[model samples]
Target: MLRPVVVGLDGSRESLTAADWAAREALRRGLPLRLVHAADAPAAGGSDLPELSAPRHWARRILRDAMDQINERYPRLYLSAEQIARPAAEALVSAGGAGELLVLGSRAFSGFGGFLAGSVALQTVTRVERPVVLVRADQTVEDEHTPDPEGRPSADTPYRAVVVGVDAVRPAEQVLAFAFESAALRSTPLRAVYAWRLPMVRAVAEAGAHQTEEAAARRALTAALAPWREKFPTVEVVEQAEEGHPAQRLLSAAQDAGLLAVGRPIRPARLGAHTGPVAHAVMHHVRCPVAIVPHE
Candidate 1:
């Protein structure tokens, strides 16, 4: 059986927006949609306490409201709702592990020029083994497609490309696979990007040396993509080998992209959880949905 597309809700507008995005994706994948809400369990022997009643009611309301909105939007989708009596991060981690992927909402910082990824969402994303997609509240279906000839947002236009960052020296198969599959599903192009910085040596900064390094990077990128290109012959692949920071180049390439996917190495528990600098920067600033895929 195919795993369901799960979304975490918290009665916030952002979470509701995420549910809408997840429903659309679930429909595309021909999978079920699961709506989940996490709340702290009531105090010991205080299940019926007057103070605890409101929160319990609120949790149920959150789930019901989200269900109603999604059902109205996608009448034919297979959907389910669950309210977990646990902390937000723990509940999301467990629930996401049981699904194909997890969708969560991230609030954009108003004047602060970045995403307001909360603690619970960040924690779950960094710890979960499955892919986690973070959607902003302002996202809409039209944003996934190219603008109409009139320069107006329209969903009927072709989908924008899906962008993925690749490291020529240490490429992860999981990240490449996810990116290619996403482009195939959307019937859009897949852009493979690799960026690097010149060594501190002055000799390497010469025009001749720069050309040599760029040639090497491009050759490695082509070599790394050979197998996948063969496997996904229909996907139009565009390779960009640039000299710069990975995050900045990715952001520029993804300006008009439908989705941006990046990988995170699964670290041992003793090492603690954290998003790498590349993932961190994109998550905060990218306009499109960011898919964080965990790989070994």
Candidate 2:
């Protein structure tokens, strides 16, 4: 059976927006959509207290409302909902393990143009083995497509390109596969960005070495992407090899992109799970949805 696309929801607009994005992605992947609410367990002796029961009641309401909204928007979609009595972070990580993808919503900064990942979302993203996608509250279906000739948002227009941050020296197969498949599904181009920096000694001493380093970087990027290009012949590939921070280069390339994908190397729990700096930066600043694929 095909695993469903799971979305973690709270009684917030951001979570609802994430549910909506998950619904569309589920449709695109021909998978089911599962809405989950992680409610706190009632106090042992305080179960009879109205305050304790009120939160659980509200949790059910959140799930119900999300179901109704998604159903109205996608009548033909197969959907399911569940309310888990556990801590938010724990529940999200466990629920995501059973699904193909786990999507969480982020709150956009009030005055800034970036999104903020809350403690719960951050914990889940760092720990979950399954791919986690972070969607901003302001993201809409129209934002995933190119504007019309008159420069108006329109879903009828073609989807924008999908961008992926590639590590030329150690490109993760899972990351490339996911990126190529996403672009293939949307019939959009795939922009592969590889960023590197020269050693300080080389930078200061060998001023003419930049051309050589850049050429090598481009070659490495092409080699890393050659097999993916063959695997997805129809996915137009745009390779960008630049000397800079990976996150900065990816952010600039993804300015008009539909989706941005990056890889997170899995580390032992004993060593604490981290999304890494590149994934962290892109998830916060990119307007497009960001997918963090966990790889070994």
Q: What is the TM-score of each candidate against the true structure?
A: 0.96, 0.97
- How much lDDT does candidate 2 score? 0.93
Q: Estimate, for each residue in 36-149, the C-alpha lDDT of model 1 and write its tens digit.
A: 999988777776668769888999999999999999999999999999999999999999999999999999988743578999989998999999999998999899899999
lDDT of each: 0.91, 0.93
What's the C-alpha lDDT at position 210 in model 2? 87
List the lowest-lDDT window of 10 residues for candidate 2.
42-51
- Residue pairs with colliding backbones in model 2 are none
The whole-model C-alpha lDDT of candidate 1 against the native structure comes to 0.91
lDDT of 1 at 289: 92
- Which runs in model 2 stand beyond 4 Å of their true positions? 43-46
Candidate with the greatest lDDT versus the true structure: 2
**Candidate 2 C-alpha lDDT tens digits along 159-191:** 999999999999999999999999999999999
